[model samples]
Each structure stands twice: as structure tokens, then as C-alpha cells.
Target: MAKSKPVLNVALVGYAFMGRAHSNAYRQVNRYFTDCPYEIVPKVLVGRSAGPLAEAAGQLGWQESSTDFAATIRRSDIHLVDISTPNDSHFPLTMQALDAGKIVLTEKPLAMTSAEARQMAAKAAALKRPSLIWHNYRRCPAAMTAAALIADGKLGTIQQVRAVYLQDWLTDDACPWLWRMDAGVCGSGAHGDLNAHLIDMTRFLTGLEFSEVVALQETFIKQRRKPDGSGLGTVNVDDAFLFLARLSNGATASYEATRVAAGRKNYNRIEINGTRGSLVWNFERMNELEYFSFDDEPRVQGFRTIMCMNGGAHPYAGSYWPDGHIIGYEHTFVNSLYDFLVCLKNGTDYRPNFSDGVANQEVLDAALLSAQRKAWVTVEQSQHFAGRAEPTRVAAKNAGL
Candidate 1:
């Protein structure tokens, strides 16, 4: 008989869009990924209202539900706490869970600013607890393959990177205001909510940090009816943002993110050009990677769309289906959850950890500052902390200029 693996209980807070996606991952991951070293059990779901708790719990497969997040965090039976709340709530909730000695996982753009993120990172390090930020896009098989190819020097001497994440949900002028539109809750509109993913993906694929940034922001719709239908309120967040940046590897890049880009729904795309070859991937076609290699025979030289459904080469495809049968966006979250469990089983550190979160937050903060000053700003405002992991040569030069 085989020995049974240990089980990890999860307490998830919030039950909105991200909450639904995360719940689906927790419920389905164990069923599809039987080889994961531990079984994930959704122990409790936390929400602000008791009225919807029961319904959400039933739909999400949680064993129980709670109207109080603090009480949920204090439960000794809970082994992991997953936070999907808004920006303002992240720091306090995360710190409380970490203080209780639970594994902490948070949705991206770690906190409202780099200072808050740095403090959380320090606490996690001091406690020596495994913490992760949900930069789930990195788990997409095509994206992972891109990272592998880049690491293998297939895209040698990277020169330029271009990325954009565009959505059309808020394009309408009549769209109601929500927490995401409030800077107090969401930090910086599309810059943090959407661009954070691209920034993290940029760092993950290239193994480089942002050196400096020059940015611009726009608020297309300045006011809208409140969700509560009370009255009109100021829409203080940017509807669109564009920035130019230099990476520590001496590569230049352009990034654009917006919620008001008409006709572009979830069209997150990335193109990287290098001395030896080039690569491109888009979330719209989530399972394909377009490749062009200079080493290819002249007669056959062109971009080839490589289907990444092959389980052998892909990261998380084998467990689902045979080659050519592709997965979708939700599977990325499942893969991330599986990876987190594997790390727990092996007692290993999770990638894109809090340190990476802090690094990404630094870039987001610098972009906002650059937009404010109308001048180029170094990403590492405090080189003393930012320069600890990566060398500060690029940042130093930018600061002296």
C-alpha cells in the first residue's frame, strides 16, 4: 500500500471575481492533479456579509463560511490563508495571518506601495514562512515555455520587449464606479491592477529589473454613478497608462495597460526581440507561442506558431489531456495552486515570492512618481533596500543623470 500524503486546509477571504477563480482552482486542482504531494481542502470561505456566505460556500465547495475575517484567521485548524481582498486590506490581513504562523498567499500588486510591500516582505522573512503573490500569468504553459527558452539562450542577447494588457469592460461612460476606481482601495487604477502582471511577467521572462521609467496616465471617464446608486462620485483612478522603461539588462521596453481600450478584451500580448531570435505570446490564444529563429534555414524562415499542448514539453498540460487539446485561463490558477502545494510538500520556497512582489511594487511606485514629476524616475527610489538582491548599477547611473 502507498503512504497517504498530508492534507492542507485553506481559508479564503473574499468571494468576488478573484475569489471565484481561486475557489475553482482549490476545488479542481486535487481532482486533476492527483500527483501533487498534498491534498488541498477548502476549509472555510470568509466574506463581509452573512446573507451570501452560505450560497457562496455551497457553490465554491467550502466546508464552512464566516462573516468575520479576523475570526477566520485566528482558527488554529487553518493551515493556509488566501487573501483576494482589495489593496487597502492586504497589508493588515496578511500581517495578521503571518503572525498566526499560517502560509499566506495574496493576489497581485502586493500592497498599496513599495513601503508596505517591503514591510510585509521583512515580516515574512523574519518569520521564515512561505509567502506567495498570485502572479498567476507566469503559470501559463506558453509563458513558462517562453521563460525556459529565454533562459536556455534561445532568444540570445535580448534587445527590446513590448507588452500590453487591454480590456473593454469599463469603456462605457455610464459604467458604475466600484472599489477598483477608488485609489484608496486599488492604489493606481490600471497601472497597478493590470500593468502589475505585465511588469512581473517582464521580470520573470527576462530575469531583469526595471531601472527607470517615464510615464503618462489618463482618466477618460472622470465620474460615474456609484455602485450603491446613491450619487455621483469622482473617478480618481486612471483608465489608461503608458510607460517607457529600461531594464537592468540594458534592454528598452514599452508597456501599456488600460481598462478602456475599445474592442480589446483581455488582449494581453508580449513580444520580445533578441539578437538570435524573437518570440511572441498572447493571452487571447493562450496555448500558442510564435517563434522566429535566425538559425532557421533561409528557405523556411518565418514565424511558427508552436502549439504548447504537448504534455512532455509543457509545464502543466500532461495532467489534463493529450497533445493538441489546449487548456484555458482558469487552468493557470490551478497550475499556480499545484505549484504552491508542491513547494509545501518539498519544503521549498515559492517563486515570485514576496521579494519579487516588492521588486514589482518598486516599479509601479516609480511609474506613478514619473507621471507626477513629468520626468524620468529611477525605479529604485531607495537603493539601500532595492539594491540588496539585484545590483544597482543601472539605477545608480539613472540617479546620477
Candidate 2:
């Protein structure tokens, strides 16, 4: 008889957009990537209300459901705690899960502030628990391919990077206010919710830390009706943010993130220019990577798009489809889950662990600070955690994907 694989039981908190994405990933990851040593069991789902909790449990394939996150996290059967809750709850729940010796996975923009992220990082470091923040874009084959090429000196001497993440969800004033628009609950609106992803992606692909930033933040809709139609509430956070920064490698970057763009529906794009070549990736055309090489004859030099669907040749692509077939946004979550489980099996640290969260939070803080002071703010300020790790080895292999 074959030996049984180890099982890791997961207790998931929250059941909204991120919650559903994570649940789907947990259900699908092991099915496609069978090489991981452990079987992921979605043991329980946690949410605030009874009706939605039960509904989500049935819909998302969780065996059980609970309303109390504290009780769920403390359960002995739960070996891992996945926090997909709102920003305000991330710190407390993550700290509790780590204290209880449960492996933790949380959604991004780790916490409302760097101080909170630092505390979470310290706890994870001290306890040595497997922790990961779901910066899922890092797992996208196209993005991973970009990282591999950059690491291989393909984008030699990075000189500039331009990234813009735009959405139209809140373009109309009638769009009801939610926790995301409130400063206290979800940090800094699109500044954190959207720009955070770009920051992490830039850091991952270029292996460069942000040195300084100057930014401007704006609130287009100052007030909106409450979700329940109770009353109007003040919109204290930014609807848009644009920033300019210098990276540690002496490269300049410009970033713009907003929910008020009229026609951009989930448009996240990045273009990196270097001495030898340039590369561009747009989420709308996620399966293709556009590249321009200086080595080409001057008469013929132009951008060429490579479809990043070559199976087995691309990182995390083979498990999904044959060459030329495309994967969607949801597959990114599955790829990240595969990486997480692999790290668990190998007893290795997960990439973009709490330390990365803290580092990203520091950049967010710098952007906010620069916006407030109207001057460039150094990312390594007094409050920034000083013990951040140096550039570690890139976890993904250099392949065609």
C-alpha cells in the first residue's frame, strides 16, 4: 500500500471576494499540482453572519462553518489559519493564529499600518511558523517569467519602470461606501488596496527596494451613503494616488492607482525599460508578454509579444493547460497556493512572508508621508523596521513562461 500523504487542515476567516478566491484555490491546487507532499483540507469557514456563513460553506466546499474567528482559530483540528478578513482584523487574528502555533496566510496590504505589520512579522519570526501574504500576482507565469529574465540580466541596468492600476468600480458617486473607503477600516483606499500590488510586483521583478517617494492623494467622492442606506459617511481615504520613487538600484519609477478611471475595468499594467531591452505586461492581456530588445537590428527593432502559454516550459503553467491555452485571474491564486504548500513540505520559508509585508507597508507609509508633507520621504525612515532581509534567491526557475 502507498504511504498516506500529510494533511494540513485550514480554517478560513471571511467569505467575501478574497475569501472565495482563496477557498477555490485550496480546493483546486492539490488537484492540479500533485507533487506537493501535503493534502490541503478546507476544514472550516468563518464569517460574521450565520446565513452567509452556511451558504459560503456549502458553495466553497468547506466541511464546517463558524461565526467566531477566535474559536475557529483555537480549534485543535485546525493546523493552518487563513485570514481573509478586513484590514482592521488582520493584526489581531494573525497574532492570535501565530500564538496558537498555526501556520498563517493572510490577504495583502498586510495591515493598516507598518507598526501592525512589524508586530505580525516579529511574532512570525519568533514562532517560526509558515506565514504568507497572498500577493498572488507573483505567481502569475508572465510575471514570474519577467522576474526570471530580469534576474538573468536580460533587462540589463534597469533605468525606469511605469506601473498603473486602474478600476472603474467607484467611478459613479452613487457607489455605496464600504470599509475600503473608510480610513479606519481598510487603510488608505486604492492607495493601499490597488497600489500595494504594484509595489510588491515591482520589488519582486526588479529585486530593488524603494529608496524615496513623493506622492499626491485625492478623494474624488467626499461622501457616500452607507451600505445599509442608514446615512451618509465621510470618505476619509484617497480615491486615487500617484507617486514617483527612486529604487535602490538607482532606477526611477512612476506609479498611479485609482478606482475612478472611467473605462479601465481591472486594468493593471507595468512597463519596465532598461539599457538592453524593455518588457511590458498587462493584466488584460495576461497570457502575452511584450518585449523589445536593443540587440535587434536598428531597422527591425520593435516590440514583439510572446504568448506565455508554453506548457512545462513556463513556471506554474504546465499544470493547467497545453501550450497556447490561457489561464485567467483565478489561476494566480492556485499557483500561489502550490508554492505555499511546497514550502511547507520542504520546511523552507515562504516568499513574501511577513517580512515582505512589513517592507511593503513601509513603502506605503512613505507614500502617505510624502503626500502629507509635500516632500520626498525616504522609505527607510526611523519607524521603518531595520531588520529587513537582503535580496534572497528568486524562488521561481528561469523558464520560457
How well is each residue in 330-363 modelled by candidate 1, as lDDT tens digits? 8999999899888877889888889899999999
How many steric overlaps are in each model, in order? 0, 1
Taking all chains together, the TM-score of candidate 1 against the true structure is 0.94
For all the candidates, what are their Cα RMSDs to the real structure? 7.1, 7.3
lDDT of 2 by residue, 240-270 (tens): 9999999998999999999999999989999
lDDT of 2 at 78: 90
lDDT against the true structure, per candidate, is 0.87, 0.85
In TM-score terms, candidate 2 sits at 0.94
Model 2 global lDDT (CA atoms, 0 to 1): 0.85
What TM-scores do the predictions have? Answer: 0.94, 0.94
Steric clash pairs (candidate 2)? 314-401
